[model samples]
Target: MSSKIYSVITGTGIYLPKKKVKNEAFLDFKFFESNGKPVERPNEYIVDKFQEITTIQERRYVADDLVASDIGFFAAKKAIEDAAIDPETLDYIIVAHNFGDVKFGSNRSDMVPALAARVKHKLKIKNPDCVAYDVPFGCPGWLQGMIQADYFIKSGDAKKVLVIGAETISRVIDLHDRDSMIYADGAGATILEGKESSSPVGILTHKTRSDTYRYAEMLTMGCSYNVTEKNKNDLYLKMNGRRLYQYALETVPLSIKACLDKAGKDIMQVNKVLIHQANGKMDDAIIERLYKLYEIDEVPKGVMPMIISWIGNSSVATVPTLLDLILKGSVENQEIKPGDLVVFASVGAGMNINAAVYQF
Candidate 1:
């Protein structure tokens, strides 16, 4: 094959909030079931059980004054700086976030200008051709934005693109719901440059699937589960945890295998798997199943780097954040060097799932 343009990640950054909400912080929380029945178990046991299953010890919450766009700008600035490129040279700013800038102490989401425009304004980029937009594909949103960036690069329509995954889920959670603790606020960004090479490099292959017909409601926004709450108008993020878990277990491995297959790469050749930090146990199961699909008996150690223990699930922000950390050598025992093959995968709200194969 002749030389071709590929979307290669040139720079990356992440913004994790300073407000560290530890598992103990929720001990005093009055958790309630969807049926309005209060969880009667002692909070100590509940916290321990949660920790055992999710492996989340603490998660970050953005400061009261900040929202999704603010943190996204923070990460975008770092990525632009890291790439050592002029801001005006950028071609696109794609922000993937579910709740659009939900302000602190307010349940309403402000989406008039779009998060990407707000980020662009903060960046002060003068390029009118630098198209900006928002993507809301659930947790897979960030990876999907990256897939779109790849297309722009390959089509020769753009030279550089900024893909950001940012979320302020804390502002939209029902405090009384136990699942509320699973959410955190964070942002991550990457600058992808179109590089022409004779051999395959940068993004290799990708696949995405949306099971909306039957699984659209797997995750949604709903009124507070607390029956005592009078604000029926304010809805928070809701999920069918059991069904979602099972759904991911059955699908994520297949998605990964499919993407790797498209890349003509074997599972054993992958150096790392950057998966969405949703549930620790579920991630383990998904990886295990992926190995089973290859007829392998053991998953390589350190193949998947996990941050959910401390960072929690920031929805679309998870995979990109994880990638940034690994690249920066911040993730313990996890590092990616040149010529390494890695997989980025995520599953979330739209009952959506996606995976991308990248070679550094």
Candidate 2:
């Protein structure tokens, strides 16, 4: 008898709004600039200070007519089509998002049924047992959703699971705020299918840690209850950039090493190191630290910096978007072995850090 293989991502798809916002375009906005000068953009100064940091170039945004659910639905359908799986086979759908469809009335979880209904109606699938809900875990939400789906599939309770991370950060962003400048809006999906094999090359090991005691490090709160005028600027995302960076640099490398160690693999065995496309400078520092800690002379150059110039940070959508970019020839000509490991590590707003090891 073969050991239960578990779940693996069979198909991946990403949907970026057709509209592309560039860094140069941001300079024209009065709020994005400093005293009518173009030096206010985060990338402008940060990239110059750090040679390794580059630009995002372009990022997608939802049309004024669209919302987060629309982006989520588009990515989900594409992923389902790519997997060649009927919607009826999808036993579960997990949406990872901090912002939901309705700002006040509906929670993130409420969007799930509507999304499932849309998929059902669009695909015309007759599966009656589909379960759908949202997992609101900030940036690490997508990986957490993946971990949950994996468990459900492994328990023989589900055959096919659709995991999606979608965000419309633009809606909540205080365009006048510098901290919100780095955020954009997008969505991506992955199909995790249950299988029976001896050695499944899917999600191998997962670990997460939280330091919520530092919750104030990044927060958004209201001073008044009135929604009309008093709360006009209450919905924006705020962060202590320096503090968040400290936590990430301190925690993520150890988490990555521990994840690899749990899988009984060495650092050299990993092919791609997919860290959250946070700040380009911070990412470079983390990579350098990792290399020095491991005593490795030559650090691998497959590290992808996805969120620097264009899209900013799309929160949970970052990783899947990075995956899509890699699959779509962004990282072409790179040699990747069959059993090579891929590392996904992220430190999010809740002071949460998570790392997952995958073999491809």
Candidate 3:
């Protein structure tokens, strides 16, 4: 008999910094323009593009003093509380981040273990059995982490899994670069517990696609083979926006359709569509194309687009943060119904795209 693993999102939480950065604020910043000259703020362009595509007003980030893990801690606390599961019961903690707390030759492999210990200590969980590790992926980290946790839970290796996607993309960005304007920092967490039911409310199907050739289209770090002694700014998120847009527009629809097909579901059956929140314009263009191509009526609505405008892209944390906002009644009185199919999709710097279907 095949062992069954039912993965359910028992709890969800997110953390953002107290500071708020508005579109108008960008105009005042010296770095917004070249040679210290004032230039038209990019916020208007972003907003107009986003509003046409997504339903988002604001996003969040981490405070100046805090790192990605700090935000992760806050989100984890909320998820654990929501699940009513003690920290002591958690058998494993998986942290997903592309931007970790590594600086100039010093590594922080202990970061996850330290975070787990802190949570365990604060909760006063005596002699709790918990192991912590980190998983790094450009954008699919969160969903992939969920899949990893599901394997352990289904195999009876772990009773509970605390999975978090946290990122401090802001730290890696060269503030002078225009790309920095679209990067932010935040964290989100989910609690996964084993269930006896064969059917689960989370992670029904997941599909991943990567075109390694296009990997160079959006890269940060320099490769060892082609050693070019560039400045520090070269080590930031760089992208051929047009190429990425083309690839995403072409690939995402098929990927989403394939996932739904694998799950034996239809596009119209889905209630909400949650993507990586890459940008407002790109998302809108894809949605428009999908509608035209599929000829599907009643396209799902009320997506979180403004979050990217306000908080920029928080890398791996984007989806979970948006989910937290939706769950916490931040999505303008929208109610999630039973059997509602929610789609999670992401496209990131790896030239990687993934789509997963979840029913709740």
lDDT per model, in order? 0.94, 0.72, 0.70
Per-model TM values vs. the true structure = 0.99, 0.84, 0.81
Judging by TM-score, tell me the better candidate of 1 and 2: 1
Worst lDDT window (10 residues) for model 3?
A: 223-232
Q: Give candidate 3 misplaced runs (Cα > 4 Å).
A: 1-4, 29-59, 102-129, 198-200, 222-234, 297-300, 303-306
Cα RMSD for predicted model 2? 4.5
**Pairwise TM-score winner, candidates 1 and 3:** 1
Ranking by TM-score: 1, 2, 3
Write the residue-wise lDDT of candidate 3 on 1-360 in tens digits. Answer: 444667788899888777665544444333433233434556567444444443434545456567666677888889999999878788888888876653332222335455545545554667446877777767778877887887888788987999988877755654444444566678889998877665556778888887787454565553222123654224545555567778888888888888888998877777777788777777777766665566864345663233575666777888888788887877665656678788888877677778888878
**Full-model lDDT, candidate 3:** 0.70
Question: Counting only residues 3 or more apart in sequence or on different chains, how many pairs clash (N, Cα, C under 3 Å) in candidate 1?
Answer: 0
1 against 2, candidate with superior lDDT: 1
The sequence of per-residue lDDT tens digits that candidate 1 reaches over residues 249-297 is 9999999999999999999999999999999999999999999999997
Cα displacement (angstroms), candidate 1, residue 163, comes to 0.4
Q: What is the lDDT of residue 270 in candidate 1?
A: 97
Q: Which whole-number lDDT from 0 to 100 does residue 297 have in model 3?
A: 46
